[model samples]
Target: MKRIAIDMDEVMADFTKKHLALFNADYNEAITLEDLQGKKLRDLRPHLVDEIREYLKDPTYFRDLDVMKDAQEVIKELSESFEIYIATAAMHFPSSFTAKYEWLQEHFPFLDDQHFVFCGDKSVIKADYLIDDNVYQLERFTGEGILFTAPHNIHEDRFIRVNSWANVRDYFLK
Candidate 1:
């Protein structure tokens, strides 16, 4: 079976709003990761680190993340023809990795421990295909990328530019 590595944030889960809300609650300001260079979680202001540290302490924060539209249906359909694995950049933080894994299990009961992989860099992960919203990650895994577009201005140009999971499904089916 073809091995497909999927990103959890944005692709399978709606993290943008929740992440912004978490940051706003912690910083008392409506700042987003886009306010930083690279527009990534790791590029946030140094002062935001403490807030992030505190926010991640709550297990419910990760557990409450909403799954993307049609995610369950898409994953179920894709899994029938591929060995699906949930690989996410959000899993890089050691403190929240375990909780994130637990949350994924609870949120996506169709996925098991063997179907998940927590990694900082996806370039090194072995996979026949990878679906991610981050342009940098898509560039890193270009040969196997199925880039998922997001509402971020920074990555608007770099992602493969698909609007929905149905597009992704069609790409692979063809």
Candidate 2:
């Protein structure tokens, strides 16, 4: 069976709002991932990074994360045809990893432990296809890339460009 790697944040789980909320609450300043790209997490004022680390350590934050639209259906359909694996970035804290796994179990009951891969980098994972929101990750994975669109930037290219899970399924069919 073909092995497919899927991203968790933004693609499967909606974490932007929760992340922004926590950042604002901790730093008393509104900060987004887009703003932190060039800047270092340690340099952020009021130590927002510390709070973010704490948030990751707690599994409750994962409970607030919602699955993307039609994600369940697409995942189910794809899993039938391919060896679906949930490949996600590791949490900053060790406990956060466990929380993330638990969160995945609770939210995505269809996924099995063997089908999950928790790692800091996805380039090491072997797969036939990688579906992710981050362009860098898609570029790194040694497989066919399916770029998922986000609010900040919409990547338009020859490779798969999908706004929703329905589009993703249609793209695969074609």
Candidate 3:
């Protein structure tokens, strides 16, 4: 079976919403999703640069993430036809390793233990297709790259874009 690698953060997990919620709570500001879409937390508000990074260190940050809509359904369906592996760059936060693993187990129990691959560089991962929100990961990948839409990668046109899990299902349906 053709293997497809998926990302966890903004791709399958709702990273933006969680990040923004924390930002809003801490800054005491009401910001729309569009305000920070396609821009990093540091770029949008340099004042919260340290606080933003500090949030990642908190276990609650990774453990309390909301799963992307339709992500579980599409990934489950794709797993039946293709090898589904969760390839994520998760080495930055030492506390995130278990938090992320537990989160996946709770959210995507259909995936096997072998399906999880934690690494900083995705170029080392080999698969037939990679669905990720980070363009740099796609740039270094050898296989087909499917860009999962995220604020930081809105303008990137290097790879086919999947706006949502429905788009992912449609892409492979072709």
Candidate 4:
């Protein structure tokens, strides 16, 4: 079976939406998704870098994230045919490791601890496929890469794009 490395952030988890909500609440301002388009949170608001980092330290930051639409359904189906592993970048925030672990247990109970690979860089991961929202990670990956669309990566065109989990299912079907 082909091994597939999936990313947890924007690919399966609604990371951008959660970050936007956190940013708005911390600043007490109305910031629309358009405001964060094509840029990361820290890059969009450099002044709030400390605040963003502070939030990352919070236990609920990663644990309370909303799962992406259809992610569970598509992943569950994919796992039946492929060896699935969740390779997420969680080393930056010390609290993220445990929080993400707990989050996965709560949301994706089917995935066990052995299926997780939490690291600072994703280049070390080896698999037949890597589905991630970050182009940087894909650039370093030695396998076939599928770009899971996020607002920040909409303009990227180097890899195959899967805009939704339904699209992901279709892409893999081929």
Q: Assess each prediction's global lDDT (C-alpha) against the native.
A: 0.74, 0.76, 0.89, 0.87
Model 2 alpha-carbon miss at residue 13, Å: 0.5
1-174 per-residue lDDT for model 1 (tens digits) = 888888887888787778777677766776754564336553566756666666656656666788888888888888788888888876545666766787788777887688788888778778888888877787787357776866553446644556678887787665
Q: Please identify model 3 stretches exceeding 4 Å from their true place.
A: none
lDDT of 4 by residue, 8-93 (tens): 98988888787778778868877777776777778877887888778778877888889999999989989889999999988878
**TM-score rank order:** 3, 4, 2, 1
Query: On TM-score, who's better, 1 or 3?
Result: 3
Candidate 2 accuracy as TM-score: 0.77
lDDT of 2 at 120: 76
- For all candidates, the clash counts are 0, 0, 2, 0
Give the total clashing residue pairs for model 3: 2
User: What's the lDDT of the predicted structure labeled candidate 4?
Assistant: 0.87
lDDT of 3 at 149: 91
- What lDDT score goes with residue 17 in model 1? 71
